[model samples]
Target: MDPLHPTVDPARFAPTLDAGATFEEYEALKAILLAGSAQFDVRAVGEVHTARPSFPLYTASIGSRDPQAPAVGFFGGIHGLERIGTQLILHYMRALLFRLEWDELLHQQLQKVRLVFMPLVNPGGMWAQKRANPHGVDLMRNAPQRAESGVPFLAGGQTLSPWLPWYCGRPGAPMEVESAALLQVVHDELASRPFSLALDCHSGYGFDDSLWFPYARTRRLMAHLPEMFALKTMLEQSHPHHAYSFEPQSNQYLLHGDLWDHAYDHAPPDHVFLPMTLELGSWLWIRKNPRQLFSRHGIFNPIKAHRIKRVLRRHADLLDFLTRAAFAAPRWLPPADRRMQLQQLATACWRPRRAP
Candidate 1:
């Protein structure tokens, strides 16, 4: 399914930051940063400057930082309007922090795994309440790779103008500041480990929430297809009835400059980097509250207080499942002798079959 990205009035999306606007999410993030600093190794990755205030891009990590330790990263807010995605990460962080005070089992798990978070990557865009950042660039599409063919018009990234949505910056231009910062975080924190998994949260798509793996730039299988399927099987066996459509982003549509694809490609050939996006379906939200269609923020976020809570509460298990999977990756990952069998299973389950 496509975003069916609703266009607000042209004047409302004039590609400028609302300097006077305050971002409640950024402020809440700071509070959480302070509260968790005692346990988390927190630091600013970069700073996003607007006309008046500059938001500090932050990353907080905990657990083992050992080079060999498996790592899991939880990221959100790459698109400003998807506040629910950011909230989900923040909720996971807050809950994890509260549990650390007494949950001994979690602490033991942390010792074996590294957990990192970049919950609010596009605060400036979020502050301005626009999907694109202040420069009007879609960070998800800012990577250097191009879709050689078969990309839908504007939805797959464009260069018509910054005024247009999903506008990738001018050709040959460097990535946006937020996009670069996120990539740097991925390289420094996630790819350094031998086994790592990154989940970047997003919303504003189909009816059922989805778990999309990479190769968004094409319909081919990812390099680590066997490992990806192994992880999927672990989740399904553990959760039994979780509500997620696990598939490749290409299964929905092809797109250009998918950052995760770049990140997965850039990882050292020996490393296993599995990046998945949790696209929380917002059409369901819009259906339940038809009035949401009129507002851009409402289109990507849950407007009602209760629905917002429901959205946040349900995803914590997924996050927890990831850390557990990472901690026990060596155990669940198929042996060299079994990789071919797992790959065959993965292809059967995910690869689209051609009509005879």
Candidate 2:
């Protein structure tokens, strides 16, 4: 038996996302952290206790340790069923570790920008083969934020029952362990800085990949709209052939308890905090491999080996762009004088509907 994925049967999943597969992810993360331990500050920020044993929620940082430095965080696996999110983050972490061995430019970049990673935030959810964590609360919907406007039925996050998908949790209860851990890391690492960005990797969206910014609870523009637009413009100028559809999350649909929305709102008023979701287009994978429709995991991940590799490779440039962007935020981020102009342009392109 392959010890890495022994707890869950691969036949019951897509090729790579067995319930037991999170074990492999955990072990690999440990090895990577060890290999770069000299350069990394790793912490077991929280734990997920269950009937069998407790699973730790680990966070790690490598690069400028100065609190004042610009920081960018990469997170994944908040929804246990969407293991590809975790995989994408792990892939980038591994690549960065190897690159650090000899990439002089990367070493220099690290001196200027802090990078933090939480590759697996919901180990219990992955182990249980569910989206919600051990207690059955969806981490994304566990944040203490409610939509000001109407939202999609059930999908908007409901307090009705834990059995229902998108369950926020018992009303008035504290946030879930996974959710709290994610926020803690953000507050201590990313939000504390003058300029910061977060990319929460996820999947199970539409036909094309997307990078969605905050204010998921309402059809409104965020304080960083100009910065977001500037970043988007930079992406277009830099990677002219890229395929991601960058926009506000509300442009597609709005929902309650969006963690990023809460995080952005709570960040320091003086800080430029831009949180985004890397919503991978899993439907493309499903459309290409019709057989993927039969497996629960297949709907959210690429089942074919080649497709998985392609997906893994395609996003590397974007991740790198984010790192470079964070490192050079002073160059691209709009200044006080230019924010209104850029905000107007951004509003025209993103939020045509004025918020009430």
Candidate 3:
């Protein structure tokens, strides 16, 4: 076994990821964080042990530590095959850290908004190049929530076998270590705030990049529909040419154990939490490069150097937009009367249309 991925029990599970390459990238990221340690609070929030190796999950934050401050978190790598998600976040973090040296505006923004990053939530999975963690439990489907109905068999989540994709793990088993660590980060960093937003980056679903809000377990509108609508409005107005699609995850498909839904539903009532998933469509990549369909990782990530750079640059502005949106939540979150109007509009836009 590679030193970077020492086996604890070789017979129990087979390693499928490129552990050496992934860990090397992880080391470089950790070094960058250390280099800019003075600008942020960084820590290994938790660790996950695979049969071959153990991976530390790190969460870093910059800006105010005040409980009342608004926060926005950027998460990636929940699916190991979606390497671009992790890279996008790490790239944004690098930009922020570098800007801290001279960007006084960012310094002032930090005074009001907290920024958190968990760039590699499933390093073990990334190392193995598998969607699930080392144990074959899909972290996205490992949360406790279950869909009442309308789930698409195994695609929604299943316990038939770990060998199948979208396996939710054994019934009643504890959440995976990476999943728990992510939830803990949300609880500590964003749950206490009066208003907060979280964006979990992912890919490999459709042809167009999409921004999906909560209630993944059902098609029902969430309690914060008005707030979600307002944010969508603001984002549209701010970036008129942005091509990303925005909707509830259920619009795509109902699924069990969506972590963001679990977090949003369980957030403090006094606080308004809006968690989103940025699913960068990979079909477009495959369409452009037909050969990519043959590579597992290629289906979920942009493989060519130029394409990868384009993907990063395309989403960088949106990440910055979310940060600024968090800072301005008080200004645009909608007043009581306006919220009702937005709710009606949200229903018209997002809810499934009834037969007329």
**RMSD (Å) of each candidate, 1 decimal:** 8.3, 6.6, 6.7
lDDT string for model 3 (1-356, tens) is 22111223222223326645446447656765766566667778888887676777877788877789899999999999999999999899888878878899988899888898999999999888899999899999999989855688799999889999999999999998999999999998998789899999999988999999888788788999999998998989999999989999888788999999899888998789999999999999999999999999899999999999999999999999999999988888888889889999999999853212
lDDT of 1 by residue, 178-265 (tens): 8898889889988988899999999999899999998888778887889999988888999989999999888888788899988988
TM-score of the candidate numbered 3? Answer: 0.92
Summed backbone clashes in each candidate are: 0, 0, 4
Q: Candidate 2 on 28-131: residue-level lDDT in tens?
A: 76666666565667788998986564677888788876789999999999988898888888899889878877899988888778889999999888777788
Alpha-carbon runs more than 4 Å astray in model 1 = 1-21, 353-356
Q: Please give the CA lDDT of all the candidate structures.
A: 0.86, 0.85, 0.86
Candidate 1, run of 10 with poorest lDDT:
1-10
Q: Score residue 333 of candidate 3 by CA lDDT.
A: 82
Give the lowest summed-lDDT range of ten residues in model 3. 2-11
